[model samples]
Target: MNDKKSVLRSSFLINFAIGLLIFFAFTIGLTTKVYIGGGIELYGTFLLALLILALNSPYVKHLSILSKNQALVLILIAWVLINNAELGRGIYERLMFTLFFFLVYLFISEYNEWTGFCLNSIKVLGIVYAMLTVFFALNTGLYVNIVMPVFADYTSIYQQNYAFLNGYLCGFTPNAAINAIYILAALGVCFSNVIVSNRRKVTSWILPFFLLGILFMTGKRGHLIFCLIALVLVYFINSSEDIINKYSKFVLITFGLVIVFIIAVQYIPALANVFTKFENQTEMGRIDSGRFDIWNYAFGSFLKSPLWGHGWDSFKYLFEPVYGYQINVHNVYIQLLTDVGLLGAIPFYCFFIMSFKHVKKAFKFYKNSTDLKAKRDICFALYIQVFFLLYCLTGNPLYDATPLFLYIISCAIGEYYYSTRNKT
Candidate 1:
């Protein structure tokens, strides 16, 4: 019994460390590169997580049985990697990120009881991220002029042309798209805390809206739309007749707050800037903001090599000559189809379909569950999954550490909940 307790404690600490590393990596956009190296540096939090796994190898068990959906995703990932092998080092980096997250998922699934540790760790990280965002927004000049320059060497992409009322608050990453997703994920964590009763009602209510405020500050219309949609889904899906009755006062108060915020925004000229920017950007001529041109060029390239397609990370190479500036396809599905062709896209599509199916099953199970915590966990996982699906429509969430790690964590928790319930 003592030995078992020690193992559990050690596992929880390791999981907590992993969670912290993931959040740190996401905040800094350190997903692909670590600075310390002569030729080949370590990449992201995966190496640290991998070392922890090695230390705990005795506790790690090989998965003897995979659900059909799980097996299909693995097959799809393998197919994508195998066909893109000619990309060499580029492909290897991508493979390592995927494999590291996969191993983390497997470990968590096997130790299903540790889901609480993961949730608490993420909640702490979310709170810190939210605080930083608020601070940066309030001091945009300081962040841009002082903080940003300090990390100039690590910055990958910075949009100098995009204008915002207060200047975009990208936190550590220069890419507003990545910053938007991080804010959304932080909101999900706050929402989960509210549902689980792990946080005070007031704190829970304020945190999400606060995070949403930062998200809007980033001027990412797609992310803001998808986040609102995810929140609505989470509320309706998890709200039972009894639960609704219990929280009716809280719900009414929240509704009142939204109304008050809207009225206040109209009176405050400064507050109206964000809304005006969004309205102006929605004009039919400016809606896509030049993405259509890039998408068209990418599609044309795909047509040239329909079957095998360009190699991994080949979109920029193929489009830059024609477009004059290097840009991604902007749409992940289209990007995959263009990069790997029809054959590779089959498995990629299958992976998402399978993942959704698994989450749907878990959602249904928890909806009927008598345990409140189980229901909250399921709802939280579902919200994150929705965010992932919606974000993929406009950005490549698969390649980024923030969204990918959150997706993996949510799926692992859901799978653990489903498996444990069945065993009982």
Candidate 2:
């Protein structure tokens, strides 16, 4: 048993290290010139997960967290083939990525030793990613013109789209909104790390603030709003602490942070510009910026084939003329309802239901957990879950591979730690 655990540990750490290199390789580039649509770092991350599972081939038990997901791939196939739907190569490829990431998450979840480690990794990665994002947002003009040659192609596109606000901060990412999806995901992880920690540090609190600051500059309205919601939820989550410490203190801290940033906006042009855009859009009564039109279109389309979606990314052919190159429904639930239909979305829905059940249990256990590591991991997993659920209200995270994997990884982490709490 000892030897087996050691080998599993070795495999996980080795792959995690490789994952870090891939993260920087693609992320630091002026543009992910190397990241085709799927995001190369995501490939490295999920492929490394497969490597870990491959190395730990002899399993004693199945990952219960995956039981509902067992039917997702099958449901997808039958939904597409049965409808005689045109499953384009791109959608099919992304679906395959979804399947692989889901399976990899399932297989590796049983090895619970790494949950704590991953929480730490997410914290550090979130901070570093946030710093890079903030710097890029503030210096978009400098970088686009002088530093990163690869972003030249998208220079006109970015400038035109962001003419209202500070430039799209996620200039280096595959998609600004998609980048915001997982960055918000990471923000949840780090947010919980600080809120639930037994030993809080200055950096722990500062990290999420920095991440939130950069997210504002990105001008991703959905991500920015939902991320704040997730943070407030984290602060007030029932913990084995006095009401003042857990709730009152957090409320005060959050209030203070908001006050500080509000004052900072008065002085910081970049931050001030974000609010100016929001005000300008609101005054025009176009706060949604066309998302409502897209959602209405996708929802009505889903009604045409309510049982299963029109087929994966069915909107691509129909959407370009209507929405101008935007392929997603910008809402995952609606996307599922549109892509596979209600019948096909059963498994996908079940997967979230199952994960939510675990998260619900994790929150219950968190209130009483004396084990600090378990508490932190459990909270880390919980907020990541919250981030995804809320983010799905206005974003198409599932349509992108990296955010999809990050979302599922949170489910796995939640399930693993929740089960451990039950066992104890």
Candidate 2 lDDT over 219-284, as tens digits, reads 677777777776667666745577767767777877897899889888765665457668878999
Give me the runs in candidate 2 sitting further than 4 Å from their true place: 1-9, 12-14, 17-51, 54-87, 90-93, 137-141, 146-149, 152-168, 201-203, 241-251, 321-324
Name the runs in model 1 displaced over 4 angstroms.
Answer: 20-24, 30-35, 38-48, 51-63, 89-95, 154-166, 196-204, 242-258, 266-274, 368-372
Clashes of 1: 0
Q: Give the worst 10-residue stretch by lDDT in candidate 1.
A: 156-165
CA RMSD, predictions in order: 3.9, 4.2
lDDT per residue for candidate 1 within 362-386, as digits (tens), equals: 7777676667667666777888888
Q: What is the lDDT of candidate 1?
A: 0.67
User: Candidate 1 — which pairs collide?
Assistant: none
**Candidate 1, position 216, lDDT:** 67
Candidate number of the best lDDT: 1
Count clashing pairs, candidate 2.
6
